[model samples]
Target: MSLLHRIEHPRDALAWEGDMPTLGRYTAGIAGEKFFRAIQEHGQFLGTVCPICEIVYVPPRLYCEQCFEHLDEWIEISPIGWVHTFTLVHLDLDGNPLPEPLPLAFIQLDGADGGLVHFLDEIDPEQIFVGMPVEAVFKDPAERKGSILDIAYFRPV
Candidate 1:
């Protein structure tokens, strides 16, 4: 019988498979490195701005979906942003319940046309709101790993 057939919950089966490879640093692509590096090394959060539509894309991209054009301009975005949506995750991605819940949020950064999803810290769940002002918390420069996780999490400005 397949290993999945022995599992009770489909979610749990998937989590077990996902955790099979858990001991390595995953490399980000060039664009992703550029974005994370800006935040880690320079303490500057940046995004790709669509020159055609004039819309700033957070989670910086090399191409614009709307404009269908390559974006080469990197603009610094204000760390301040408003929380658009949020959720309190009681379990980790591996399906193991965490000792404490973590609150993740999609924040629409200031001066940008869209939002980025990341974890939020230093605030109570009940206090989180749709328009709460928050800022990115970057990892110490010397400890950076050129990954999105380099930004520890977002917190109240």
Candidate 2:
């Protein structure tokens, strides 16, 4: 079946509004399980390094995307990273105006090629900027649940 459809006008596009039928659980896969597990168990960040390509994947991957080599070297990386990009969110989840803006950033972890996109806290949204240094703040050991929430948020270092 052809999935593409042509519409003469933007408003003529077909739409559907209702509860979605798609539902399932997301298992973090082999590499992701190791990555998040390290954070949950020890409050540490783990990355996989490719020896041939010499690329470091932050959320460690099972195979090197560049060379297709199996990745088995897991290394602990510093939670410290720099804000590669940032934004101030002034709208709530429902598109309503928020009382205070929320800051979010894509933090490039040191010694890794990729980064994590998460909420930024402990500083004014107006102060956020590119290349700003930040560090992950983890929740208490008892509160961790082997999830991304295990690390509460990233804050200015």
Scored by lDDT, the top model is: 2
Q: What TM-score would candidate 2 get against the native?
A: 0.85
Candidate 1 local distance difference test against the native: 0.84
* Leading candidate by TM-score: 2
Superposed Cα deviation of residue 57, candidate 2 (Å): 0.3
RMSD per candidate (Å) reads 6.2, 5.7
lDDT of 2 by residue, 1-157 (tens): 2558567586786775788799899999999999888998899999999999999999899999889999999898999999999888899989999888888889999999998999999987878889999999999999998998898999999
- List residue ranges in candidate 2 displaced over 4 A: 1-20
Candidate 1, residues 1-157, lDDT tens digits: the string is 7876676767865554334656886665656778877877798888888889898888788888887899999888888898999999999889999988889999899999887899999998889988899998888888887667777899987
Q: Which consecutive 10 residues in model 2 have the weakest lDDT in total?
A: 1-10
Model 1 has how many clashing residue pairs?
0
